[model samples]
Target: MEKDKIIKYGSLTLVAIFILSTLSLLFLNSNPSVNPNNSVLQGYVIGYAKISSYDKVVKVQNPTKELEKLLEDLSKNGTIVRSFNFENELVIELKDEKDVYRLNKLFNEYNSSIFADAIIDFENLTFFDDSGKQLSIPNQRKKQKITPLFDIAEPFKIKADAIVGEVSSKEPVVYLLSISLLENEKIQIALKPKNITLISYAISLKIPWDSRSYIYDLSSKLNQSNITNKVNLANYLFFNSTPSNTSLSQLASSNIPFISKITKSTISLNNIQTKKDEINNLLSLYNINVIFPDSSIEIENLDTKNINFIEGLVSNYSNLNISIQKENLVEVEFYQESEYGSTKYVLDEDKLKVRFKTALNPNDIKNISVQAEVVGNKIKDYKIQQEQ
Candidate 1:
């Protein structure tokens, strides 16, 4: 009877351990709040080239109605990325590169009138034409410094020491990421312009999984002359929620009874773009979001639930349906890159990140942070144009 009791207790103990281990993988004590708007393209901005011809020659009779229209229109989607007005000529940088082409065409059509000649270039603040003709602006560039600051709760700051109790990105996930907005969290970054300013900025995020995949970016610009040169978190950081905590490979391995099926479903990519649309579609379907200035992808499905959707895609690359068997390696590494020290390890399934940057001429540019935080990256393109 004692032996039987011991055996029963031992069984119960084992079960308790198993439950705890599983709970560790599935839950967390806290989480960051996610904003649904533009989460995937967080901190992303459009790029455009400027066409130069007229300086302050043609003044805006009413700067409020006409010019402000462009600024207000920016809230929707398309907005001018860069622009400048000098005594010699007026140059405008647009968000979409497509707009640059269209404007250049218009410039040529009206070159004989007052435009002189419209030459399109990626750089802004350009003056001289190729033929040594001068389009001089009397006041070249008035320089000043605009430091953007923020107001937030404790641990966050205009300047502060390393925060305590907060986990580092490098830490492994013992529990599914917390989905709670930390209290006392808010952020602000800004540039106050006294006069006309050409702004270029890119926001960046450190992927909780890895640092090498940092090039993914979303760019934005400041085209307005005196409008505080600021962007709210809404301008750049966008996400509905955090990504999934478990990787496809991890889920497949843990859930599939057949090891072979799990192995087959985790095929690698020759080009990340090949399945861009499909992958992107899956991301949306699963409530995934893409946050930037540092490049990272996020997804929002719980484990084991969406394995079939991915498994089908892997088996048949050409078709919408199928599973894997092409490769023969029994012990293959699914994501070799993860072996390196990446912040986006397994626990980041619920992971999300966002970045912010600011570039203006004096065309010099870059981040301050907080919860619902705003960060910065200084833009260099406009500065390059100034030097040239």
Candidate 2:
């Protein structure tokens, strides 16, 4: 009987061992086993979506083989792990992060490596995830989030001091200013006239002893809370002193107005007209003859916003006689050292001309001339010249 009991217990222990082994095997299978192929999903990137404008939902005739080969070549040392279709775009992934810049360059340089007839906007492409959500090229999709160095979200942060001067042998209080980017590839600049006020329009209001006389143009540029980087400034050349033109002078003259703080970022400048209606309304006042210097800047991308402010003045008090001069203004900037810092520009189209008309009268003429002078409340060691 004792021998039988020992044998029975040994048998029971063997059964228990078998059950434990079976359970272990099942657990291993249920849990995720390490797979070598899964590493491809780790640091992947989605290619920019290229879409058709006329037919937004038009699918590519042959997407997989031709497009796939081009993307693989663009990713440098990376490989195309997987791809799928989302709407009309071919969503693709690259296994390496180092290929981000390479892909961008390739997308721009060669729209299609194989198919010459393929038209693609490689910069802006759309793709969707498993959840049917939109997935754009990472980091670069939100262009606004990425601000180049010294770019202000609000342009008004730059101290915009007024350089009140006269045109070359021209009359009326002319605002002569020149703006340039100065090797900074992040910021944009513009100039638009706001209005003029007559403290004593002997010929034109004399640049008062108070440095605050330049406040009108300053406030117009740097007075917005959240400035949309769009400076739709029309020909700041006005012929009359109406509400828009006259009110600027009388608006804020005592001190330099404060504009809200701004953050910097880049944006597009297509289909934007600087001076549309404002120019038309003023056109009714006079036959405008404008001379735009044949100078243009070629931009790489639409990363910087375009802004414009007028660069002239208003005077109903007298026939003006003012002598103006020109400087090496192929590039210029009216930068003010405000509390924040100096404003930067990627490019500035800052050429200006000032002219006003009145019946010629010798006594009515005011003998005053101006040079490019930077005067404002924010400026130090400078004062507006008082009339003698």
TM-score of each: 0.15, 0.15
Q: How high is the lDDT of residue 235 in model 2?
A: 12
For model 1 the TM-score comes to 0.15
- Over 4 Å off, model 1: 1-78, 112-388
CA RMSD (A), model 1: 29.9
Runs off by more than 4 Å, candidate 2: 1-61, 77-85, 91-333, 336-388
205-301, model 1: which lDDT tens digit per residue?
1122211111111122223332223332112212111223221111112122111111111122223334456656754775644221112222222
Model 2 residue 308 distance off true place after TM-score fit, in angstroms = 40
Q: Candidate 2: how many backbone clashes?
A: 22
**Model 2 Cα lDDT, one tens digit per residue, 204-316:** 12222122223232323443532223222211111111112122111111122221111121111122134333433442354432222222111111111221111132123
Model 2: residue 350 alpha-carbon error in angstroms: 9.4
Q: Give me the overall lDDT of model 1.
A: 0.23
